[model samples]
Target chain A: MEFGFSEDQTLLQQTVRDFLEKECTPDAVRSLWERETGRSPELWGKLSEIGLPALMVPEVYGGLGLDERDMVLVLEETGRFALAEPIVTTAVVAAPLLGRLIDTEHSAFAASWLERIASGDALVAVAPEGQPLIADAHVAYLLLLSHGDRLYAAEPDHVQLTAQPANDQSQRLFTVNWDSQKALCLASGNEGRSLQAELLDRGAFGCAAQLLGVTDRLIEMGALYASQRKQFGVAVGSFQAVKHRLANAKVDLEYGRSIIHRSAHSVSTNSPSRSVDVSMAKSFIGEAARFAAGESLQVHGAIGYTYEQDLHIWMKRAWSLDLAFGSGAWHRARIGDALTEGGLSAPHFGFEPRGL
Target chain B: MDLTYTAEQQAFRAEARSWLEASVPKQPLASFDTPEGFEAHREWEKKLHAGGFAMVPWPTEYGGRGADLLEWLIFEEEYYRAGAPGRVNQNGIFLLGPTIMEYGTPEQKARFLPKMASSEEVWAQGWSEPNAGSDMAAIQTTAIRDGDDYVINGQKTWASRGAYAHWLFGLFRTDPESSRHKGLTFVLVPMNTPGITVRPIEKINGKKAFAEVFFDDARVPVANRLGDEGAGWSVAMATAGFERGLMLRSPARFQSTARRLVELYRATLAQGGFVDAGLRNRVTQCWIRAEAYALNTYQTVSRLLAGGKIGAEASLNKIFWSELDIEMHTVALALLESRGELLPSAPAAGDVGDWLEGYIFALAGPIYAGTNEIQRNIIAERILGLPRK
Candidate 1:
């Protein structure tokens, strides 16, 4: 029983990394960050041209029809490059969410949306009920919103977006107010609830992978800077204090890698331990990202704090990702609940301001 | 990646579990440090060997079933799940046996391995000395050659199972002019050899689980050596790799401990109703770390089966597991709060706490098998490509 990715998966990872290295540099991210919408037409077109937006859509519906395992690697590359586009919101999250709605009332609409998404004609965002922070709501052509047991596939015109002051300018968040009845129905009752639950798992699991990438990049940035930064007429990395701190960060990064990979495997395969692993990845890697970002900043001395350094780009990105999909404590509490309660049944994450 | 066992592996697991379920002693065996308990442990090892279960990963001719590494992992998981007693012959079967299979001559294998598998000659490690714990190259133990025999001298400290082991394996200074890792010899010497002495050193737990072995002109044939005299350093490093990587502490051991820890946490919750979220989070954290390590080992074993060799990065694994063990037990103690101090025989004991004894034993984990500090240095220099200090 192997616990690592396959040869094909490794190849996919390398290809995505290569593509991002060419298309989505720090300059690209900085350019997008300065935009009103944080949307890059050229880069977004490149993502769709490569069939990434179709990775989860069904092949019968004119899409790549790949699994969550494939998405995991792509998401990591996105994190590594600090890609500022709505790929996670559209391709990774929405494409799959609609794929699972084939048996629901919006079967025809979901299929059409999947095709549109595959061709880069549509951008999708999610405003999942109880999870108030909606990603890319302004740019999304369709928003997947859940109300009670009903899943609605809505257009932005039917849903009002109130932009928030975002932690990571590369990716913006909005509080969405929607007319549920005006939207096309996707699913309702048990099917809808199950769909939303699975979406939450997938989203959290995807965030874990991205956090791993963020942390890995943070550590690399830290180690490289420490090696060059001089202290006492020698490299800072030569000192035990600097070495040990980076080593501890390395330890966290490595340990978090195994958990993140396991999360991807289990969630993709629908293993019995999927929820368990997702919680582990969310909680473990969330903390790892913070630690890596904090320590890397400490290692860089001062310039790391500035926007000009490019390091803060990833630092802000890691924080934004970690703060989303549940705080570490929030996921840890679910883990604690699984440890003591009904064993991870209906595991939930994030804020709910309701009935106001 | 697939994480399920094959049908054959499942069958093998069933076979091992059924045998263990029936054969494992209902009552625990005595501690190996005591004389009677030592004999009992030896007998237990003999029974395991007779069942072809002593060393599942060893080749068939060497008294194992010729099981692959994954099967060996499954065997260990089941072994611990069945509440099997600790391996009294671990030093021989896990550490030195694999080292021998790799480096021993046919004669050395024929003479030493079978007896080792059968527990007729339990072994102790002679790697550490008073002058050398983390800096193993500082060993001053000398074994000068005289005709066909080597006159052994100097002292070895912290030889686990030395007090009751029938044989001990270690490195010695074979060349007088040489220093550090040079001129050292790795040899297996019988504990019954004249001029050899074993003195059990009381540990913090008041148990003498290991001892100090002094060689005062002890004489042994040169044939006892595993490899060439000065080449011992390289062979010793391979053995250390095995110790820190796979053999000495399999992931199953920690997984089992984690399972028991969950049971403890559950029982604690049942009786008391609640633990703070911090402590509960810690319990989950420990469980996650154990599972992560187990999966990591699976990946490593898969790599090995596919022709990958373990390297100094195993120092990272050592640091990870050792620290996880300490954290798991420490949190358990905190969960116990007051009963944390209760001994195993205490009236309130319910198989839920380390009772400070196991915690005490775990304290030596990072110290032995190379201190965590040394492991970090290895990671920094070898794995991370940092400058050596």
Candidate 2:
């Protein structure tokens, strides 16, 4: 029972980190503010080239078929770099949502879209479960939106889109209004209900994982700033005030990261506690990342609050991600209900067949 | 990372579950701080020892099953799930035991471990002093060597379990002229030694859970020292690492508390009171923190099992769980509102007092085992590589 990621997962993480380090530098993240699309086509193609969008797609559908554990780390790297691409919504969420339909009536359409995603020919932006504003739908080739238990695969041309940029401008949201009668029906009834359930789970959990990564990056940034920034003829980091602030954030991030991994494992393995686990991860990490962002900015003094500073890139993303899928309050409420129903079965010692 | 238990681990869990189910008192044993309660806890430890469940993570040579960290975690989960009594020998089995295993002579192991497991002698920590609570290096308790014996003379305060413990494991100044952390010796001394005096210190809960121990030429044999003279600082830090890491506060303890807290919240909600959204959020956050801590411990345990050692970053674990414990209990107390201050024995207190008791004890968590303030400094300097000014 190993809790450490497998060698393959470790390699995947390293590869993603290295790729983002090269392709999604702070300057690259900064460039998003000026672009109308708020995304890099070249970087997008590169991510698709490395098969970031294909990781969640089934192998039978021309994709990696690797579990969320593998891609969770990738999403984390994207967060670390504050990468402005829609990997989470498009690749991680949409592709997998489609993959689960491989044995359903939408198999052919799902396969075609997945192949396009794998080949960088199309990006499918998903509006999961209840949300009306679909992120990445402004630039997406296909928009997967759900209402009730029915799912539709709509073309960009088939929908009227009004762009609603997030507080973190790296994300561009679109209020999509599509003619459901004209769109391709992916699934409905029980199949669509199941698909929607997993979609929200993966999306919410992915958001938390990404926020934790950003939290880690922010702590690193804050620590570096404190070490170099002088105050009273000493490194700011040496001051107990600055040290404790960052330390608190570091503690939060560490625990948040742990839960995110656990949540991912729960989703991947289909644990009975998966819903509670995801709720716990999202609610906790949303707060942790917010703390990291606030402390990191405070430690950076004036520079962190400025638009020109790269620190805001991750900080704003963390703030925005905290509100994604479902807010921390929403998740917490759900967990409260769950606790009322089934008082925590186990405090998840390890993932079984528990990942030791 | 998979979280499923292996068949063998599951079987061990089943075995432990059944044993604890049968052996755990239906009614809670009296507080271990009380005289009768102390003996009852001692007997409980012996029962656990006879069942080979005293120190699951320790090696067989040290009266343990040689279980790995993962199994230890599982054992802790089952132990807490079965509502087992708190380990009276926690200071021994969790902190000093691991340190001694790393630094003790084979003879020391043979002499100390079996008895510690069987509760023949319960150990208390004697690290903190009047001037050295957080700054442990400032310890002034001297143990000047006199031939094969060391004459201990100084005061150690806040020695947990000292009022009832039969033995003590602590650090002392071995060299008269050396300063700070240098020239100290880690030693184990019998509580009945001549010139030793234990004065109970009442806790916030009005319990003598700890004491102030004074020594005036208390002669202990040199063989009582665990590591070489002046190596006490590192050895004590290693012991501190154990206290901070998986040993002392297993995640299961907090998790169990979280589960109970939620149950309290559920009960509170059922009463049709104004359980505000803010209160609900805090309660959920408490449970989430517990789960995160458990997951983090498993991750750390996995790392340790795969030949990794916990270092100063253990300060992270220390701060996280300690604070989480306080928060969980605080939430539970908040759920009780006006009844929050009641003692469990009070007829009017109802079920509100256990949380109050837990909250009172948890308040001491960040203060003891090295204050969270000290822990943050370790994290800032050791983990973040920040300078100490």
Candidate 3:
């Protein structure tokens, strides 16, 4: 049996890689990062032209109907560039979650939002981690917000223009305000928290996958820098210290990949470990990004820390994403609390499937 | 992408389940935690071979079903599900069999495969030496060419299953002057050869499950050689790959065990004292990890079915479940609390001590079969394109 991606999948990946290399290059990303726009609207249309925005949407709804794996591949490539795209929020998160929430035969609100999302006209913005969120933003057709017992999405009346400078600073963040009439209840009470938790878990898993891709690129950047940037009459990469750090980075990448694999597999199977896998992966990879990025910067020496260098872009994203959902320490604490309360099953080989 | 088994596979699984249900012994089989216990387990293995349920991975020519990896996985799942005895001839059938299939002379296959399948000749691996655990290239086991035979001399440590194993398949420095990895040759030597000696090492659990074997002029026929000289490393890798990949443990077995763990948890919780909120949270977490492990196995199986080679990423699966094994046992002990101190044979303790025993056994999960540290090294160097340290 083959575990490699299918020929079609390969082509899809290659196409996206090529597109990002040619159209959404590092320079393009830097340009947007400088502008402080969360997305490239023109590029957004171009992505729609290439049909990425519709990959998860059903053909009947003017979309690609691609599977979750395919969507993940796209997101991963997007992350490699650290692209200023809301695909994760709009396509993967809001669309799918909204798809599930829609009471098909009769819900006008759901149908209208689905049509807008499918047509690639509407964009969704998720709340920054640890923020008190208002479910109404001017441009967003639907804003997902959760409180103790409720999840709401509605129209905004007098949205605030206050700047909420996010860690990624590149992605635009705004503090929003809205009245009760604009808040359409997605779910009443604690069910909303469960829904939000599930969505957050998916988001965490996706972010981990993206971070893994970024880590791979960071390692490559370090390798290239080490090869070219000479010191002591030889390429810096020739040093054992540099080599070992890169090697450890490689180990982190592999570990992160395995964790992501476990998380993805759990999500696909609706396994009980879905949350745990997601938590472990988010925790592990968050730390991995920090290490890999720092090592990569060190490998590149002084140039890496400069704003002019593309390396800082990755470092910024890495730091930003590390703290995005929950930091590594946060997830670690969750796991630690669980282990202290209940004995860990398969603690060392947590996800290895053997004869149980 | 489909993880579901075929109709033929389903039928095979059904037949296997029924056979196991009808034939499984009432009492627990001898454990592999000790060398003596392993020998006791071998007798149970003979019963398996007599019934033709052992060695399903071997081809039909050797009296097996000529099954593929999928069937082998299924067979292993059923073996563990039935609470079957530990594989006494695992080294012979799992490691050596596959290596022989790829590189053995026809005469060698014909001579050894059937006997190996039937448990007539159990085997142990002789790869790691005291100085060459991770760096197998540094092996010092010498096999000097002699008239019609090889005179072998050196020591092999941590040769798993060696205490009662009948034979050994290993690499030797056939050309000492040659470069480290270039001088090796794979060979099979009888465990009880005149010049051979074995001493079992007791583990923390007071069980002797692995041994250190020494050889002094252990004359073995050239016919026992596997593949050509200088090609021992590749052959050994192929053997180790199978051991680590599919044979050491199958996903189905783990899936069943996970289910059983849940059952055990439910039973333990039924006692009420253990049902605190913290315990409940942990139980849920363990349930999640177990489920994730099972799904990952399914994904691996699906990949295999889709015609992919299980490569370095197979180590990913290995790392995942090995950690899980430790976690599972640790959880079991926490469930037992103070009773976790009991020895397996203690009169006051029943199976409660098995959890503590398993907890100790779990410590080795990441150590042997290539330490998780080494696995991470491989992942970085090979899988992740990281620089070699």
Candidate 4:
């Protein structure tokens, strides 16, 4: 197996890293946090125009159709800047969900919608929370997974919304009421379940990759702050306690990144054992991000606690997504379950997410 | 880009696993923590050697299977899966064998390698001194020039199996006037040589895994010198590379241990209900970390199969896996609660208290080979290209 990144993926990562660093800074993150909408529509359009959402879409559908590592690079860069965008939610998650839909009975509708989403022509926000038909926020589409069949997608307008205060000021959560009339059934029966599971696995990979970025950036920021900020006439970083903490954080970051790379490879190849891997990645990286972010805040002391500083942006970003899909604890249980089951089920490729 | 094994590799794995399943000893060793344990395990090694499962990468003349690395990795994974005993002569076969293959005189290979593969002699490492753990370059174990031989008069600590080793191979200073590295020479000395003394160190676990050796004019023939007289530094480094990097403890060993830990955890949980949240959390963490290391090792092997060099980053794998072993055993102990404090002789014993015993053995992990702190420094300065401290 080739562990090295493909030349194209390497170039793509470099390009996206440059784009995010140039276009979005901590100030940009702050501006987005202050806004009620939390995301930048104008910047979203630019990313869409540049085919940011289409990297994983097949070339036949007028998209780049790159692999999971490419998306990992994009999400990683997006996370580095703490970009307040749902490229992860829209491009990596919803768009791919729609891509799966196109291969099923809903091809006609999914095809047009996917093409529009791939280009900058259309927009789709993830279902805020609650259920598919119960979103509290307005969006072009609501993504939901049902137990028996495919994901039932409903328009936000058709669902009754209930608002809840989110942990991060930049992001809000919503609960929705189900309305089959307004929903488009993406995948059903075995296909639907299979599609949703695969998508979640992929999304878990994306989340882990994003967390690696978050942890790496926070570690760098914390180390720099410790070295530059002096306490008692010496650099705080010089203290053994601080150094050990940073060292531990660095170890956590490396371990987290290693799992992400492995999980990405597993998903890309349709390895049947991807669940155990994804669970391991999500659980390990989830804690690593939490630890790194918490230690960063501690190292920075009082200023880091204040909303004015940029560290909380990353802290909130990690916390929000970490709890959204599943917390570290949840993944840990999954790992335990997999281990107790003797081993994980081997991953099967080419089979639709539905059915065995 | 495919990480999956080929059909041939898969078949080879099945074959190895089946053979090991039939051949591996059913009874666990009397002790995995002593020199006697090493000797006891040596019989198992001999059985494997006779079965053609030993030294898979070496040539047929050397009593090897003449297989490639993928086959070797498959064999290793399956060996662990089958719960085979640890290779008692690992130092001789893993490190010295490869070094001799590359840099030894033909006579040296003929004399040493076959005996090593066949377990006729067990080898011990004599590199670290009391003053030189992380700073191995500062070794003060001197080997003064003598007529037709080198008279060594220094001490080495933390020598694995040295107390019962048949022979020892490592660096000794031959030119005190030269730089620390330049004055050194790698030599093989029979443990039975005159003026040699070995004192086994009873560790916190009460097992003697290491020893301290004293040489009061211990003479090793000039013919036993490896490579050149003054080129010992590089030769020792090659052996250390194998010891610390490739197939040292074998990935399969850790994989099997991890698998067993998971099984043991589940069984304990079944026999008893949830003892505490903290212990459960730790158990889960250990299992996952171990699995991650297994994957990391596979990636390392795959890289080698694809003709890539294993860089210093490989140190991270050892650091990760060893620490995980410690953590897993720690969790296992806390789960046992008061029962964990009991001796092996106590009634209502659990799993021979191997986990508890292993927990104690694992305490030396960061202190041996190289400290975890030193490993991090290597990663930071060498792999990450950070500036030196």
Provide TM-scores for the models.
0.94, 0.96, 0.82, 0.87
Off by over 4 Å in 2: A341-356
i-RMS values of the candidates, in order? 8.1, 3.0, 6.6, 5.8
Question: B203-234, model 2: which lDDT tens digit per residue?
Answer: 97688999999999999999999989989999
Candidate 2: Cα lDDT at A317: 87
Candidate 4, position B389, lDDT: 30
Note the chain A TM-score of all models in turn: 0.93, 0.94, 0.89, 0.89
Residue A307 error, candidate 1, Å = 3.2
Distance (Å) between predicted and true CA of A147, model 3? 7.0
Better of 1 and 2 by DockQ: 2
Estimate candidate 2's RMSD in Å. 2.3
Query: Over the stretch B289-379, how does candidate 1's per-residue lDDT look in tens digits?
Result: 8877877788788888888887887887888889998998898788787778888888897664443766887788888989888877776
Using DockQ as the yardstick, the better of models 2 and 4 is 2
Each candidate: how many clashes? Answer: 0, 19, 34, 19
Relative to the true structure, candidate 1 reaches a TM of 0.94
Native-to-model Cα distance after best TM-score fit, residue B239 in candidate 2, in Å? 0.6
Local lDDT at B101 for model 1 = 89
Which digits, one per residue and each the tens of the lDDT, describe model 2 over residues A197-223? 777887898888788779999999999
Q: Compare candidates 2 and 4 on lDDT and give the better one.
A: 2
Model 1, A37: alpha-carbon shift in Å?
1.7
| Among all candidates shown, the one with the greatest lDDT | 2
Q: Docking category for candidate 3? A: incorrect
